[model samples]
Target: MIGAYTIGKKAVTFGYKRYGIPGAVASGGAALAGYLIVRRALKRSTNADATGVESAIDAGEVKSAVEERGLGAVTESETLERAIDEEDVGSALDMNDVQSAAESETDAMTEGSEGDSSDER
Candidate 1:
């Protein structure tokens, strides 16, 4: 009976010693996974906001450029005109339309540059 008791005590002591390491490892892994998820989500949100801002800037730029250069300079300029009409608040000075125009212009520039690069290859 005493031998059995000693063996059981030894087994419990060994288990206790091993348990701490595995417990710590599991906790660390969970924390890392949670941190990575949060980081990725934040990055995605930031990128979306940046894209929105870029679009607004493009619209403004396109409006100014057309005003300075003339309507003939803009290719497919009707898109910007339509966005302005959809807003329907002002005729000559609409901020939302300016933003949309800027975005479209930026997108065009990016695509054009990419096309050029691909053609070179």
Candidate 2:
């Protein structure tokens, strides 16, 4: 009876040892896959945000430069005529919208400059 009990105990231990290796391997593999997926998603989101921010900064710089150089500074009527001639009738932007956007950008730039000057004092 003692010998039989010892054999049963060894068999259970052997079974557990045999299954444990594969279980541990599967867990590690799953963890690695999850990490890779999250890492890739994070990288893509970061790249997209960076691209959007860069485009915004570049647009602001161009607008500021144009304002400083007084380039294409046309009256509203002239701007309307030019837009009508150059763009299709179905174009989304009208003369008034363009003029208002330009005015707002200039205002913002001037405000920023004034703040900087004040800081210097």
Candidate 3:
């Protein structure tokens, strides 16, 4: 958003220097559109996170970082973004367990198919 605002400022403030009034208007509109696009994207992100997601963090589920932060500045609903360091939604997935379960299922399927094929033959 800051970037968008800066771009809009530059476009409107100095666009006239290069391309006159028409260019200034065009650039200003483009910049405003870009800013609006970013604003909508961010709003959707927050809404999606706040509404609900599969295995996503619940409102009561306080992350360690939040605890560390002491919740002093935390909002009533921040959507508690799932960033790389946050481990918000991703931490729920323990890959090793999922892998083992998949491997077991594959082995069972292989055994069953082998028995069926031999019986048919």
Candidate 4:
């Protein structure tokens, strides 16, 4: 157990010497070269090798759909809309017809209730 502890401590010290502390203060160029060589040997965690900058933007890791930053006053901005669709127009007409039917039914029920109360009197 004592031997194992000593070996572990030595291994951590070795790692810190090689990479943990940025380039040695004694030599500039050689130290930087050593650091670069060691880094090249290690695996990179970025997708830079597989995708280009355009792909990165298209992937949209940074979202853009948030409400715009503005003052407290509410203001409306005209947004670009798609050309009017036939299906949308048809659905709107159908919705208006259904609304009219519902209103007429409600009015008839109200009149019927009033007539019943007068008859009871």
Which candidate number has the best lDDT?
3
Judged by lDDT against the true structure, how good is candidate 1? 0.36
Q: Give lDDT tens digits, candidate 3, residues 1-121.
A: 1244455566666557778998677656544443333223333333335222222432222222233343221222232333111233333434333334334443454477689999998
RMSD for all candidates, in order, please: 25.6, 28.5, 19.9, 30.8
| Tens digits of lDDT, candidate 1, 25-106 | 4433333322222222222323334323233222333333333343322333343343222222222344344444444554
Q: Supply candidate 4's per-residue lDDT for 120.
A: 100
Off by over 4 Å in 4: 1-93
Per-residue alpha-carbon lDDT of model 4 for 1-121, expressed as tens digits?
Answer: 1122333344345446766643222222222222222112111212222222122121110111111221110111111011111232222222233233333443454477689999999
lDDT (Cα) of model 2: 0.35
Choose the strongest candidate by TM-score: 3
lDDT of 4: 0.26
Single out the weakest 10-residue window by summed lDDT for candidate 1.
33-42
Question: Pairing residues by index, what is the TM-score of model 1?
Answer: 0.26
Please, what are the lDDT tens digits per residue for candidate 2 over residues 1-121? 1122333334334435656755434333333222222222222323334323222222222222223333223223343233222222222434455455445544555577689999999
lDDT of 3 at 29: 52
Which parts of model 1 have CA positions greater than 4 angstroms off?
A: 1-91
Evaluate residue 22 in candidate 3 and report its C-alpha lDDT on the 0 to 100 scale.
84
Any residue pairs clashing in model 3, and if so which? none
* Residue-level error in angstroms, candidate 2, position 59: 14
**Candidate 4 or 2, higher lDDT:** 2
